[model samples]
Target chain A: MPGVLDLVGIFVFAVSGALAAVQKRLDVVGMVVLAEITALGGGILRDLVIGAVPPVAFTSVSYVVVPLLASALVFFWHPHFTRIMPAVMLFDAAGLGLFCVTGAIKALDYHLSPLHAVLLGVITAVGGGILRDMMSGQIPSVLYDRQLYALPALVGATVATALWQQPQLHGVFVSAGSALLAFGLRVAAMRWNWRTPRARGVGD
Target chain B: MPGVLDLVGIFVFAVSGALAAVQKRLDVVGMVVLAEITALGGGILRDLVIGAVPPVAFTSVSYVVVPLLASALVFFWHPHFTRIMPAVMLFDAAGLGLFCVTGAIKALDYHLSPLHAVLLGVITAVGGGILRDMMSGQIPSVLYDRQLYALPALVGATVATALWQQPQLHGVFVSAGSALLAFGLRVAAMRWNWRTPRARGVGD
Candidate 1:
């Protein structure tokens, strides 16, 4: 079930990446490349930092195939996608929620401290989008987006780690609750236009 | 000796990163962060890919301290440093040369294929600058620089790999020769304004 959720998250991320490529007027190859990087880059980065070489993204054919399919769908139907931007944003939030919980859990499995696990989880959730923006010659949205993206991931990771440390919590329930909490927070932030404050006296 | 060479490369890379921060007019905190990322990012990336857990950048005091020291120097003496830009470029080339050989050798130690090792080598040589560019909101120079940057690293990595495969070669001589070759190629390319051709139909 977790594996299936991961694939679904990757697909949504890939679609978003492909849309970015379209907006940038990139060619077909660029769209696919961006999609793959958006889908797999975060997991790859998390895995590498934790010494999980030959990361699951590299080993799983499904991980590769799902993103390619998502990219293709977006490439052929981006106008429809643009119209459904709200739905897409919802799915992206879900992806963030799922990734943070799973990334934190994986770090715990490697015996990392809870604090470090939380950090890794946030990185895993945001790293792909960061890479995508960088490749597109823009500042990373996570760094500059007024929306509370990384904060939600941090909260989700913290909750997940806390639950995991409990002596009697059911794993499935813990994961689901943490992910839903993050998803809810992200959705609320978007709906309410929750914005982080910029530094004082800093001119853009 | 190789350890010392790696530190030297890191220090130079960190200085370049700090210089970039100055150009961008980033604050001191940003300067230090950029410098650390530039000096250690490539090696951390290389170590992660090769399953070297707790990367040397995280483990070694020197690796952390050198970049901090470099950042401080750049922050205080940037005007003088900028005036000697040509010499700095030469040093950057030498750093590139050293890193490519060392990175490839490390990858080879992990028993990666020679081809994979060479690729890692080039990545290690250029990855820090790429990160610095991306953080500064520019396209990675490796992707767009006209004056043949990655190519020289490629040549150096390939030479080092091939020589390492030879049964009768001395390790020290092979490393020195490969580094010199890469350094010389980079210098020549800059002197002659050698450029990799852009796609004919691609508009800048």
Candidate 2:
């Protein structure tokens, strides 16, 4: 069973996905499908890459139920949700932070190298959003968005990886600190409108 | 090590993917990346779902090498390929047919039920194309294209699954027949412009 933090992360992510479906004018079925995909896609991708078969998403009933509940909530109260978009974005950052830390830890548990663990961590953080964008027929914002999204995840993953090397560190504290760093960075980036530089001479 | 037939399928799929990259005016690196993704994404998805660790695409040198060669070929000779787009489509059909059969057999090997095997088979045949279209920021053609694409893969996968239930049947012949059936259906659909009907009253 996933912890409360993980379930909260999945619920927020699922809500984001359901909102995207509504924005695209998709029907109820599409809302459910998108919500499930967004909530589970990243973890599934990480599990697949790390040779963890029967991914947790498939095996855990709570993982599936949380997404469904989120979808239902969005479906019934989406107009209210639109008014609270900022709050949703903040929650999304928390989800990203939590996913990056947990994903890295999971990869390390599977005996993957630190570098691979970090890479997988970042992937798990952003993959669901990428899938959500693509399914909606949009370019993944992470690839070209000026905002510092993936960079924050990368920083968090690196921090987790670095801390993981020290076995004596308290595991819960290490994870909490890394996730908090990522969440803080993401929130700051949004607040200050921080932007990554565009590639020179490419788009121009 | 994959057989010659599997290599051919990967090569053709890679060619199709590279051609898409060229059509979208992507760079050489993009071409290679798309080629690899299109060639190996389906099998990898199937492998991941069935608990096959470190999918063949990662484990086998041939799978990686074949797509790289195909990408290079398309990079230098794309104009010629554009002129022979019909031929490319036919080859793609062959790849679809081969992948569906092989994917189904692999699922059955992993002791998945016939229903799951059939589903995986179709996914393996179409997953790469969906990923390619998504990565390129387009709606997946298989989802909406007015052509018989995934249907043929379903037919092939169903056939393979049914035949696998009978151990006395010759493995080589059963696979060959199933693949040929799928290839023929796809060719006929293309020649006749067969299309699946859109949902009634949805778009309207």
Candidate 3:
């Protein structure tokens, strides 16, 4: 069975994908494709970078099915679904936290350096959304939006990596602590409408 | 030393990436990043899927430097470069042809099925451009434009994969033939302003 955290993360990511498809006014096939890609793209990217063959995403049937089902649900009930966009975004933040921490641990298992592991972790949290936004013909939200999105993931990943380096640290505790930090930061940023600084004079 | 064909392909792809960065009014750092990604993203994607770790692009200083040079050239000499945009695109077609054929051959070396090899080949040809377009906040030209961009690459990759299946055919000859077919088709498509059919209701 997939972990509860993993399923929750997938659900939120899938919903974000569905939202992009609806925003684009794409068809049913497009919705499913976008959802699957958005939900799984980050993990697939991490696996590839870490040299994991065929990736778990391709090897597991449920991984593929869950996202498609989420897309389908969104497609048929968009009116009710979009109404909860704010709550959904909050869940997405939580998913981001979970993914970043887990991704860092996985990279460490593969013997990546702490720096590379943290980078991979951040990628696992945010890469899918970048892919989705780009595919939808918009600037990547992480780059363009006035939110401290990517930074929170980076912070969480860094925390996870640092904790893992301690010989006495339990991996589960590291993961849980990292996730909580990231999740708290993301939720706070959203609630406060926090903005990351733009390059001076570039004026984004 | 990298093959002559590989260098030429990288040069053209780098130019295309730099063009995107310039259009987006991004800084020098952005130009280099975009160029590197455009020149190497497809091959990296292929390598990852094939379980090739520490992708060749990362290992080779030349591959990294060449694209940076191309981007710098474009940044300082935009007027001269843009004036020759048509010629640059022709070279890009040649590069596309080379990458698809070579990419398929590489996939075959890893014992992938012919179908997967061919798919990887096409991906290796066009994936970078998709990334570039997405980063530039535009719809991918391959998906948005009616031109036979991806089709030519698909034809070349399929040809390469099929020829590799023949015991009597030398891999070099197979690559040459595939590249020629794709390059010829792309040039013809450009000269004649040929187009692929769009989905009926998509209404391009």
TM-scores for chain B, listed for all candidates: 0.96, 0.97, 0.96
RMSD (CA, Å), candidate 2 to true, equals 6.5
Report, for all candidates in order, the number of backbone clashes: 0, 0, 0
Q: What CA RMSD would candidate 1 show?
A: 6.5
lDDT of 3 by residue, A1-204 (tens): 227788789888998999889989999888988898889989988888887768789897878989988998898888877899889988999899999988888888887777778767987998788778777877767654657787788899999999999868955777888998999999999888877643233445
Q: What does DockQ give for each predicted structure?
A: 0.16, 0.15, 0.15
Candidate 3, residue B4: Cα displacement in angstroms equals 18
In the range A1-204, model 1's lDDT, one tens digit per residue, is 988899989999999899999999999998999999998888888887888878999899999999889888988999999999989999999999999999988988887777767767887898899889888988667755557888899899999999899758848899989999999999999999886543222334
Q: Could you tell me how far off, in angstroms, the CA of residue A188 lies in candidate 3 after the best superposition?
A: 2.7
Off by over 4 Å in 3: A197-200, B1-36, B39-43, B54-130, B139-204
Q: Report lDDT per candidate.
A: 0.86, 0.87, 0.84
Q: Model 2: runs farther than 4 Å from truth? A: A1-43, A49-51, A56-130, A139-204
Q: What is model 1's DockQ versus the real complex?
A: 0.16
Q: What shift in Å separates residue A1 of candidate 2 from its native position after superposition?
A: 13
Candidates arranged by lDDT, highest first: 2, 1, 3
lDDT of 2 at B53: 72
Which regions of candidate 1 deviate over 4 angstroms? B1-36, B54-129, B139-204
Q: Write the per-residue lDDT of candidate 3 for residues B1-204, one digit (tens) a residue.
A: 228789889999999988777666665545665787799888988887787785667456667778978977886776677899899989999999999998899999999999999999999999889877778777789996889889999999998888889878955777888998999999999999999887788775
